[model samples]
Target: MKYDVAVIGAGPAGAMASKYAALNGAKTLLIEEHASIGSPVQCTGLISKAALTECEISEGSFVLAKMKGAFVYSPGGEELTIRGKDVKAYVIDRKLFDRELVGRSIDTGADLMLKTRFMGLHHGRISVLSSGERKDIHADIVIGADGIMGSVGRAAGLPRCKKFLSGIQFEAPYDACDAQFVEIFTGNKFAPGFFAWAVPFGRMARIGLAKNAGDRPALHYLEELIKHPVLASRYRGSRTEHVVGGIPLGAPERTVKDNVMLVGDAAGQVKPTSGGGVYMGAVCAKIAGEVAARAARKEMDIKEYEKKWRSAVGRELALGMIIHKSLGKLSDENLNEFISFLNRPGMSECITEYGDMDHPSVLLKEMLKGADKMRLVRLLGVAFKTLF
Candidate 1:
């Protein structure tokens, strides 16, 4: 089959790209290797309210719970509460959510191809294995929304993300302090270079953590997490579902090469601080789709996708990387001090008003404006120098 644009991967990013491509008059094809979408779920399913708006979807059957705040625990077990006046995020069922997105793409005139595995891209020809048979589909432009492994990008000889955090999680029955608030745990002993979390929905919680601990598998940390006093107190000792995956950070120097463009995880579009890619991926996918459609018609260069997407979210991602690196470097004692500083009088109010899951730089910038700025600077180490 031949199409104007062929988008590989049917995740949120691929679905959005195909939808925009079709809406822009391109004959778009959305390809997925799996027989279905959203299978083998790798995400925590926690997404911000702004993510839904970015994806252009209303609250649907996929939303399982609404979150209004978070309870952060320092290495010393100190609690810092950040309460939002309104719903800030949602816990969703990724299967239903992904299907909804792909359905939108189909409705927008994009063709869906299931059980089609992208073999490679060669000489302007798209190759795939479908129904145990090799086939070739022609397309003027290719958009890769594949995951962190970036199969499509690799085939096109693109550089991969600079770093990857090993992540593991399980869904289990848990007694949460408050269903409307997620719980965050921080310390080198547990997560090492990253953090752990318990995102609750109803009586169940997705408990997991991502860490930069080299050589030691994430499962090692997962075992430590469940034994923590906070988690052990609430965990029912039985898990219903488990997820293990890698979260990529640090986008490569280039995301576009020739007629090919990369978006979403393939392009390292995830937020470094949160390991959340949906919001940023959706933002970039729209640009990739539009640019692919135009490039197919010779109205634009494929490079425009790179420029447009970066202009939109590059600075935010860069700043998030700074914060992630800064936090990852802190010793347990320093972390305790940092969290303590945030727990100071009037500090909770400042955090509650400025804390944003999507754009952490805003909160950091605001913190620098406060009188205790020097304290925070000392806590962040040398990374603070590069943040601004």
Candidate 2:
């Protein structure tokens, strides 16, 4: 089949990219390797409200729970509650969510092809094995919305994301203090570089962790996480539907090469602090699609895709990397001190007023307003130095 744009992958990123491309008047085709749109769910499904807006979909069957806040557990086991006055995020069923996104894309005039596996690129075209039959398609612009194992990226010889974290998770019946408050576990014992999370959905929660670059695997961390004093109390005596995956961080210097552009996990647009990609991926994918469509018309260079997307989110991603590195370097004692500082009389209120999942730097600036306090000064000095 021939098209102006071919988006390889039917995940949220690819769906949005194809939808935007079609909306911009490009004849777009979205291909999914899986028989179904969403299957073998790999995500924990905690998405910010802004993320939902970016995806342009209202609450649907995919939304399992809405969360208002998070209960953060410091290394010393001291709990601090970061509350939002309104709904902060949602816990979703990724399988249903992916289907919804693809449906919307199809509605926008993007053709859909299932059971299509992208093989590689040929001379100015793409090779795919569709439904057990091999074929070649010529396209003005190709988008690699595929996941971490993106064949399009390989075909284009794009560099990989800087690093990857091993992740493992399982759904289980949970006993939580508040249904709206997700639980965060932070300590070297549980996750050395990153943190563990229990995102609640009614009486059930998705418990998972992503391990930093280390010898230990993600499952090893999951094994240790379940035994945590907090998780051990809530987890029912059962295990089912476990997911193993990799979380990518720090995008490669280039996400666009020649006539191809990368979006979502394929581009490593995930936030290091949260290990979430849907929000940032959607933000970048729109630009990728628009650029791809415009480039197909010979109205813009494909490199415009690179420049525009980076100008939009490059700073935030860079800041997130700094925060991730700072937190990963902290000792148990340092974490205790940091949490203790936040537990002070006036601190939580400040966080509540300015905190945002999609923009932590906003909260950081607010926190720095009270930098007269030496502890806050020391911490901000270290983190702010990285940003500059």
Candidate 3:
């Protein structure tokens, strides 16, 4: 089979890319290894309202749980509460959300092939394994939207991912959940490299943790976190439906190569700090789709795809990686101090704004002013030292 663009994987990234490519007049094909689009859900699905607004997604699309505030728990049990007058964040039903995204792509005229796995790439042709049959599909350009361990990336010779976080989340029916606030627990005992979260999704809450590069299982860390004195009592009788997965941290060495572009988890576009990629992935995929369409029309250099995407979102991701690394080094006491400092007056608002997945660095740089300037500068200096 032949196509102008062949996208591997049907995740949000691939769906977005294919949707745009097809919308731009390219003959686009989207392939997914799984029979279903969003089965085996693996994300906590917590995101800021800005992301939803930018994506043009309505709040009614998924199970919406409004978050008016957040609570940060220090390892030593110190707590810092950040409350907002406006809506801060929302917890979503990832399975339904992902399905809606893929469905939109299909509705936009992109062809989909499910239960098909990408085998390899040879010349400009891709070999796909479908129902015990090996078929060679040719395309002018290819998109790798496969997850962190993407075969398309390997085949394209993109650099291997350097950082990873093992995450485990569960949907539990809980009687006592602060629907207006999301709770974050920070400390090595609960989660290393990342903080654990309790995201209220209506009647159920999603609880999870991301583990650092050690041999420890994320479940073990989750077990410890749920058993924490503050959380144990509330979660004692919750009914749990578990979701476990791994996420890539850090920026990709190169998101584009000859005749191919990588998007979403395949290119490690996830926010290193929060491990959220839906917004970033969709934004990058939108750009990649336009670039691929132009490339197909011989209107632009294919390499321009990398240049555009990197300029648009790479710096924030780079900064996020540095922050993630610095956060990994903090002890319980350090987290307490950080949270305490953040809760002082306007600092929490700054931090929340910086946590915007799109322009993290802009808000981060803004937070570097005022009384906490020295501390913020010190953190950036450490980030620079570590990243360089």
Candidate 4:
């Protein structure tokens, strides 16, 4: 088969990329290894409201719950509530959500190929195993929207993301304090260099954690998490489902090499602070698709994709990385002090006004301008001080 652009993986990034490619007049081919789209769901499915807008999706049946705010817990058990005046995010059903995205791509003139596994790229041709048949597909440009494993990138001799976090999650019944508030846990005991969460949807929640590279497995930390006083009090000890995955952070130096381009997790377009990719991924994928289509027609250089996407999100991603590292290095005692400071009068109001899940850097900037800036500087220390 011959096409102007071939996109591997039918996830959100791939779907969006192919849709834009076709909409831009490219003959786009969207391929997925799974027989059905959105199988073996890997994400916690919590997405910011801006994420839906970025993906060009409205509130659909795939939205299980709308979240207004979050309850954050320190290792020492101090609670800090970041209350949003309006809906801030959504808890979604990934299976239905992903299918909806891919369906949109198909409707936008992109051809869909199920059970198609990308084998390699050779001499500008794509080798694939489709429906038990080996075939070669020719395309002017190949877009890899695959997951962090990045088979397409490896085939194209691209470098990997700088680092990865091990993550695990499960769905279970829980006695929720508030259905509209997601709970966030921070400290070294349960999550080490990362954090754990209980995202409530009705009487149930998705409980999960992501940790930096470590000697102990994520499961070990998960076991400790459920034993925490806060989680133990509400968790019912019954699990309905489970998911395990890796989240990549730190984009590679380049996302494009010759005719091949990478987007989404394949290019490390995820936020280091929250480990969420859909927002940033969608942003980059749109650029990748438009550039790929134009490049395929020889109207633009494939490298334009790299330039455009980074310009859109590079500073935010860099700031997020700095924030992630600063928070990750705090000791449990320091976390308690930090949370206590936030619990002080007048601080919560500031957080409520500027807090954003998709852009923590904005809140950070606001805090740096506050009267308690010195206190924050003392708590966050040298690393974060560099941001100023």
C-alpha lDDT values of all predictions: 0.92, 0.89, 0.81, 0.93
- Please give, for residues 1-388, the per-residue lDDT of candidate 4 as tens digits: 8999999999999999999999999999999999999988999999999999999999999999999999999999989999999999999999999999999999999999999999999888999999999999998899999988999999999999999999999999999889999999998888988899999998899999999845789999999999989899999899999999999999999889989999999999999999999999999999999999999999999998988999999999998998888787777887889899998887899899999988998898898899999988888784455345
**Lowest lDDT block of 10, candidate 3:** 379-388
**Model 4: how far residue 136 lies from native, Å:** 0.3
RMSD of 1: 1.6
Candidate 3: C-alpha lDDT: 0.81
Worst 10 residues of 1 by lDDT: 379-388
lDDT of 2 at 329: 71
* Model 2 poorest ten-residue lDDT run: 379-388
The CA lDDT at 49 in model 4 is 96
Residue pairs in collision within model 3:
none
Measured against the true structure, the TM-scores of the candidates, in listed sequence, are 0.98, 0.97, 0.93, 0.98
Clashes of 3: 0
Superpose all Cα atoms of candidate 3 onto the true structure and report the RMSD in Å to 1 decimal: 2.3
Q: Could you give candidate 1's per-residue lDDT for residues 195-254 as a string of tens digits?
A: 999999999999999997645788888898888889899998999998999999999999
Candidate 3, TM-score vs. the true structure? 0.93
Error of 3 at 367 (Å): 2.9
